[model samples]
Every structure is written in C-alpha cells, then in structure tokens.
Target: MKFKITHITTYLFDSEVFLEPHYLRFRPSQTSYVNVSELALTILPQPAGHKMVQDEDNNSVDFCWFEGMTSQLTIKAESVLETKPYNPFNFLIYPQNFNTLPFQYNVLQKKLLFSALEVVPISKVLSDYALSILQRSNFNTIPYLTNLTKQLHDDFSVEYRADGAPFIPDETFQLKRGSCRDLSWMLINVLRQQGLAARFVSGYYYFDMVKPAYELHAWVDVYLPGIGWFGLDPSHGILTGNTHFPIASSAHYEHTMPVSGGIRGSASSKLNTELIIEKL
Candidate 1:
C-alpha cells in the first residue's frame, strides 16, 4: 500500500528550543537537511526526549524548554530496497542505540536533564515474553510471511482510541488489551526484556480497501533467529507484512511522534489537536 501522511505537534514553551548539531544514525554526517523521500527516517526534537537547542552539525546544544514538530510522510514500496530477506540479519534485531542515547526512564531518574516520565514501565520483562512468542517450537509459520515484502496488501484493525487514559502495566497484563501503542510497546518490551532486540514502529496503516490507502498506526518488529527481523501487530494478533509503511522507529514511540519541537518566537501559544482517518 502507498500513503501520504500529515502529523503535527505543538509545544507550549516555558523555554525555547534552539537548533543544534548531533549525529543522526542513518544519514551521512554532512546531512543537515531532510528531503522528500518515500523511505523511512528519524528527526530529533530534543536530544534526550526533552526540549533543547541544537546546532547545525547536530552536536552542540543550548538549554531550552519547548519544542514543536510537524511531519508529512510519503511511504511507498521501494522496488530497489537496501535490505533483503537474506542480508537484513543485522537490521532485524535492535541496533546498539545504547551509545547514542540511554534508556528513556533511566536518564530522567538520574536527574541528568529536565526530561521526565512517571510510572515508566520496566521494559525488559515485557521484551522477554514477546521473544518467546516468536520462538514457539510449535508455532506454524504463516506461508504469506515469506512473501510479504513483495505482496500488495493491507491488514489493520478498525481505528479505536483509549479514552485518553493511561493504564499501569499490571492492568494491561491482566486485561491483555489496550490501544495500538500499548500493544505495540508491550510486545516490543517483552521481546527486549528477553535479550532479544525489538523496536517499536510508528507510521501510517491502511485498510487496502481505502481509496487513499493510509492511516495513523503503531506496531512492532522483533528479531528472529532464522528469519532476519519480522514485524507483529499484537493487537491484530498476526505478523506484520509489507503492506505496512514504516516512517520511523526507536526504543519507543516518543522518538516517532508525528511532530515534536518548539517554535522560538510566537504569540502566546495554545495546543489543539485534530485527526481523522478515513477508509477512502
């Protein structure tokens, strides 16, 4: 499936976010600008998941409070993709992001920055459970899984919201249900906890039946021993196939918010959100 996506995030700054220089993993070091691409990419708003000013090289930093972000994405199948079923062994598992950034919760708890998260779920335990799901000796491989990258299809559940409420892990554990981000995060953490590397994916999903062919969604991918990396949507209870177009992924979703960053100067600002995903 092919899609066009629009995402916007606004920041109400008690502070400012300045541009800085730092390293972006997948691009050339000289890359200071992002261009139009149908492929996946990552953009940083604040270095450690908080608002900060950054320089051109993406290195030097200035202290700041608010950051605002917006992103438009075009995701289409790449006929000449860099990764292959056989050669993507390295990409399937989690990349060593430890060097670039620390665990989301650990950094804040240490009081390293103004960054924060309360009731941060301990991820290791969850990642372990997810890996076990993939390695089930009796699990039968879905034949389509092997042909997915080449398939032209779509599979996603109907859109739903969480009542804008947050639940503790124990609640999710007992209920075994939640929103897309919840299930996606839960599955990935379960896999990571087990020593298996996993990452949370965020982007647009579409019901192939939709005329526009896209909508906002979240899911996960885990590394498998025999197959490089495979994706799964625990909410949908199946493996992810090529029909899904991934925009960006990180240890978690905060890294892939539709928009994040701050506008240095503006009249008194207020945040308002609007979203609509239609089949057509």
Candidate 2:
C-alpha cells in the first residue's frame, strides 16, 4: 500500500513567549518493509537553527532551536511512502527455551535490553491479569502474547485522549479503558513483569477507510531472542505489519512523544493537531 500523510500541530499561547529547543519525531522510521519517497517539514516562526539527528533508539529526530518571542508556533510534516505486505508472524523464535513463558534472554541480549527489561511496580490485579493470559496460552510465549493482546482489546474500551502521558498500568487496568498510549504502556509493564523486554512504539496506523481523521498511534515492541524486535498492537489485537509505520520507539513512552520541549514564559497555551492519511 502507498500512502501520503500530512500532520499539523499548532500551539497558541495567551502571550508571546520564548520558544525553547524542541525535538520533532515526524520522519517515519524507514525499514525494509517501508520505503519513503518524499518528505517535507515546515515550521512557522522558523527556527534559528535546526538539524536532523538520530535519537538514542536510532529514530530520526529534527532538533530545532528558536529565537525571539512568538504567540503561536506551527509545525507541518508531509510524506509519501510505500509499504510492502508481509506476514507479521513470519519469523521463528530461536532457542527452544525462549518459546515458553517467563522468557529469559541470553547474557549479551539482557545487557543490551537493560532498559526495556526494567520492571515497573505493578499491582496484584495487573499481575494476576497477565498470569491468567499466560495460563490460557499454556505457558507458551507466542500464545501468551497473542492471548494477552486479544483479551486486552476485547475487555477494554478505547478512549480518545488528545494529550498527557499514559496512565500507569494499574490505573489502566482498574479503569478498563484508556487511549492507545495508555494501553501500550500498560502492555509494556505487563510484559516486563513476565521477564520479557518490551518497548513503547509511536507511529501511524493506516485504516482502510475513506476520508477518516487520524492521529499518532502507539503500540508495543517485544524483543524476542532469535526474532529480534517485533511489533504488537494491543489496541487492535493484531500483530503490526506494513501498515504500521513506526516513527519513534523507546524503553519509555515519554521519549517517543512527537514533540518535546519547554517554554521560557508562564503563558498558558492551547494545542491543536490534525492528521490526514490518504491511500494513493
């Protein structure tokens, strides 16, 4: 599938304020399955200096620094890309031991995935919920992930939250509803509790509909010993494939935010964002 996407974000402040350095993760992470043919980024009240650089996870990020005071800041990004279709379950899990629940990575793999493997404190409710899925999968790794993803999607209601960091796993579990980021974050922690290394992923998910509004999407990336990093979407209860175009991924969700920066003044601000994805 080929797609053309346009995303716009604007911030309106009550008064002029000094704009600080900002990092923008608008460029799609190009991989063998996804090819980018054209891309452009435009910013209003143009930055004094800007350059594209790779973040810690190797995601392309535009580092921008601005001067002067402005009441409004706008950023627009456009891109055209083609995604190849492939089976999401094409890879095989290496090392028979890793095929079971409570995954254990090799020494070097553990060292490299330290941050992703770090477990956050979760309530017994959340832990039991994960354990139930594990039992349902008969202690198999792949089934456990599939059952957890599907059950989460089936049991929870998806809410559209425009902003804010994800709610912690326990909170989401208690509420039984959350935005994409919240669900992804909860899933990350659930995997970590089971000794699996999982990371947060932010990107675009193409919905095959006509003239539908879109927003940035979030999902999970689990590091399987032999298979490497694999994408899963608890939000949709499906494995991520070509249509899942990832922009940034990190051990922590905050690092994958589309925009990150600070302001110099105390002026209150209102944010507006619009995203359009069209199949070509």
Candidate 3:
C-alpha cells in the first residue's frame, strides 16, 4: 500500500523573536517495512540556514535556524511512501531457555541493548500493576507482552493532549487516563522493570475508520534476544504493522518531538497543527 501524508504546524508568537536551531524529524525513517519515495518540507520566514543530520538512531532530522525576527512560523512536510504488509509473529528462533521470565541476555546483547534497558524508578502502584499482568499471563513470553499491551488499552481511558511531556508511568497508572505517549511510556517502564529492553517510538498511524486524517502517534519497540526489536502499540493494543510509519525513535520521548527548538524572545506562543493521510 502507498500512503501520501501531509503535516502542517504553525506557531504564532506575541512578538517577533529569534529562533535557535530547530530540529525536525518529520521525515519518516526508512525501514524494511516502509520506503519513502518522496519527501519535502516547507518553512516560512525562510530559514537562514538548515541542514539534515542523522541522530544516534539514524533517524533523519533537519536542523534549522532563522535569520530575522518573526512573530509567526509555519512548516509543512509531505511525503509519499510504500509500505509492505507486516506479520508481527514473523520472528527469529529463540535461544535455548530464553522464552520465559528472568530473560537472559549475553554480555554482548546487554551492552547493545543498554539504552533500551535503562531502568527508571516507578511508584509501587505501577510496579504492582505491572506485576499483576505478568502473573496473569503466567510469565509466558509472547503472551505476556501481548496481554500486557491489550490490557493497558482496555483498562485506561485516553485523554488526548497535543502538547507537553507524557505523564510519568506512575501518574498514568493512578489516573487511569493518558495520551498515547503517556501510555507508551508507562508500558516501556513496565517492561524495563522486568529486565526487558524497550524504547519510545513516534510516528503516524493511518486509520481507515476515521476520515483521511493523520496525527503524531507514540508506541514502543521491545528488544528480544531472538527477534531483535519489534514494535507494539499499547494505546491501540496491537503490534505495529504496515500502517504504522515511524519517523523518530529514541530512548527518551523528548528527543522525538516533530519540532523542537529554543527561542530568543520572551514572546508567548500559540501552536496549531493539521495532518492528513490518504491512500495513493
């Protein structure tokens, strides 16, 4: 399947101001599942300079700086991509005695997966909640994760927030409501607590049930000894497939913002965005 995607972001400031180098990760990262045939970006007030750079994960990012003062800025990014069908269950053979709890990673594997395995402290409430799911799944490898993902989707109510960092996992657990990033973060921490390696994922999900619409989305990728890395969307209770086009991924969600930068003025700002995705 081929998908054409457009995303527009507008920033309106109370007063003219200078902008620091802005980072843009609007271009989808090419992977075995998806190919980007064409991509373009438009910026208003014409940047003084801009360059494309690859991050630690090899995700494409645009670094931009503005010359003169401007009270408003607009950015439009469009892309054409081809995605192949994905089978979540298509995985490599597991190492001996590696299918159950207390996963064992070799020295080399541990070093390679360190970032994804970094431990973050969470409240007892969250620890207990995650434990319950593990117990219920009998700690079965694939079933455990699948059930955990689905349970999160079924258990929590989604609260959409267009800006700001996701709620910490403990907060999300207590509130029982959070945005996609919040949920994904919660899941990432939960998996990490059990010695699983997981990382944050940001991208666009093509939804047919809704009109030709698109939005920035968040999910996670877990590292399995045999399978390497695979994605799962706790917010949607599904493994990421052909329809999920990841643009940026990092161990920290803050690094994956579609647009991020510092400004030199004290101007308050308002932001608006529009996204569209259609089948080609």
lDDT of each: 0.39, 0.92, 0.88
What are the models' TM-scores? 0.45, 0.97, 0.96
lDDT of 3 by residue, 22-84 (tens): 998899888888999999999997898999999887789998988888998899999999998
Which parts of model 2 have CA positions greater than 4 angstroms off? none
Q: Give the TM-score of candidate 1.
A: 0.45
Q: Give the per-residue Cα lDDT of candidate 2 at 42.
A: 99
Candidate 3 Cα outliers beyond 4 Å, as residue runs: none
Residue ranges of candidate 1 with Cα displaced over 4 Å: 1-159, 162-168, 209-215, 263-280
- Give lDDT tens digits, candidate 1, residues 1-280: 1233343323344434343322221211111121223333323343344333343323222233323432211111121122112222233223333212122323332342121121245544443443344344222233222222112112223235523332444445546556777656554544343333566666545454534433357776644434444666665555654444455565545665444433433434444333322321
Regarding lDDT, does 1 or 2 come out ahead?
A: 2
lDDT of 2 at 219: 96
Give each prediction's root-mean-square deviation over alpha carbons. Answer: 11.6, 1.1, 1.4
Query: For model 3, what is the C-alpha lDDT against the true structure?
Result: 0.88
Quote the positional error of residue 6 for candidate 3 in Å: 0.3
State the weakest 10-residue window (summed lDDT) of model 2.
Answer: 207-216
lDDT of 2 by residue, 1-280 (tens): 8999999999999999999999999998888899999999999889999999999988999999999999998999999999887887887888888898776787898899999999989999889989988998999999888889999999999989999999989999999999999999999999998899999999999987665978899999999867888888999998888999899999988899999999999899999999999999
